[model samples]
Target: MTLTNEFFQQLESLFPKAADSPWYVYAALVFQANDRMELISSTWRYVQSTTSKAEDQIVKARKMREALLKASVLVGFPKGINACTTLRKALLADSPEIESELDKDSSLRQHLSRSEKDARGMDFFSKIYAQHTDRVLQNMSVASGGDLSEFAINAVYGDLMAEESRLNAKETGLLEFLACYATGGSVWAQAKGHMYGSHNLGNGKAEIQGAVKICDTIEETLDIKVNRAPAENWSWLAKAEKW
Candidate 1:
């Protein structure tokens, strides 16, 4: 279904301070509902018209191109290669000297003026990446997992193969789910379940390797909780009561 006014209204209410802001969610909604070619063309025209008004054409163009690339990815385009290449060509055409002049531009700063928003976006993106990558790895494992014995009881009970063809993350909502699943607990049982659900660990041989790699990544980069319970600061709140 097309994104109704209700959706935008709900989002606006949920994020009142971000009303009409140039955020991914807003752009994603448009991408989900609109035609990609028209959207990209319109966005290019808008950037051309508005960059002068924004007082820094080069910086504004870069941001618009970045947004276009993100939206393209959400709409099932190959963002890492094709969509990015297209966007970059568009940017260079619009501002042929953007790369050379970018360093000297005073008005076109890093847009850290909204550090809070930037931080929030980065945190969200990082968590999304961690979870989605984990899922892709897991699904590959299960589909490739050779023996049924490799999978734990839960995977068998849940029938993980039902999602055989559609395992990759195509939408933001799916990414959010993967992130939530990886948020806590480090016991062998939990790890097995996580690994099993991915479909990659279905084969006994791949299961162990998958688990190890996931664990290593989580330990190094993810703020994972192997032993801690997932909560909104129960420990710190308890400590604060002492003060």
Candidate 2:
């Protein structure tokens, strides 16, 4: 079935402003359908014709991508990796040197301007190490204890795994999924738990699957490999969500 109005209604109930512009919903819908390579292809095609017109549309597209990230997070949609990567890819392809162009945009400059977006990354190592006292110390209690567990988890999950500058949790989730899909490691297992806990318990089953499905689409379109490990059984529904 197509993404129904009811689906948006559910999302709107979560974020009243999400319904303000169709871009957010439209991005979600296209990703859900996973048709014709979806967002990346769409953005690529638009960029081609919009070279002269693209200056303005480019700004709009950036806004739409940001909105998509926010909306996905609020609605618990998990396609943020695709959204983040495809949006960036299209933007880069459209303008090989976007750093200056993005800065020139009066509307988008504040958020995306290099100074702002690249202002800083979370020292998540410090944050999680500071936050998850129990988890950290608990592991330390075991033979696998010492600075090793803290360093490893904080380095991978905390440092590398957590956060992209302009992305939110949903986008970050998908980013994590992409990495896990590629590596086929413990992170994939963690992502599966996150899907079950956050998205699946909510009205987000299709969204989670869409995240996985896009991995295939990405491999096809980008000619990369994914789901390198089935031992994690990420393909399994873990007993599906009603949607």
Candidate 3:
């Protein structure tokens, strides 16, 4: 699907224009997960042209890369791999010099031991899951015979989502939310979990509601339809603090 200037104007209305806000990155991730590769480069280019400063572009670019990496756990590696490659090529074509500003080896994986990584992962998982932590873990263990639970804590949470040097807890949580949302309505339960996770990380209810609207806009713009859950499925978020 072709992403028009008008479409991006709609996105800018929904999110802040700051580099840290990086709504385009989230949009790119959504497009990538949905197999709309044609729109990915244009989305990145639109953000780059509107960003005004060189340093800010670098920051947004890095966050885009980090988001693709972290969200891979939910959206699958093939899409993540293609998205990263596409973004990198787009960055190079636009401003080859900006590549040097990015971190060559930003991940903490090399610096931490396996046990330490697991601890970091569990800590992050606990923070996101909050009151639901134990129950979620128990459910995963029961559902997958302990394998999924163990991998989620040690690998997905520890190895990826817990890395906050680039994207903070809230941003990472939002990526998780977007990744699940992009995959379509069948994964709404997973999307709801990450939406709550984003809220737990300090996103306001209205902010997330705006994100949901943005996702809807993306789907509608592309003329792609999937059986999404009803809006009532998320009404409980109005009382998020209790859960």
Q: Highest TM-score among the candidates is held by which one?
A: 3
Q: How many clashes (backbone N, Cα, C below 3 Å) per candidate? A: 15, 2, 0
User: Where does candidate 3 stray beyond 4 Å?
Assistant: 16-19, 230-243
The TM-scores of all predictions, comma-separated, are 0.31, 0.42, 0.90
CA RMSD (A), model 2:
10.2
Better of 1 and 2 by TM-score: 2
Could you tell me the TM-score of candidate 3?
Answer: 0.90
lDDT of 2 by residue, 34-100 (tens): 4323544454444335335645555555545554544343233456556656666666666655534
**Cand. 1 TM to true fold:** 0.31
- What tens digits encode model 1's per-residue C-alpha lDDT throughout 46-140? 44553454335554555444443333432444532444454456555665566455435442223433443334433433333344544543554
lDDT score of model 3? 0.78
Least lDDT summed over 10 consecutive residues: which range in candidate 1?
156-165
lDDT of 3 at 33: 80
- Rate residue 80 of model 2 by lDDT: 56
Q: Give residue 83's lDDT in candidate 1 (0 to 100).
A: 40
Clashes of 3: 0
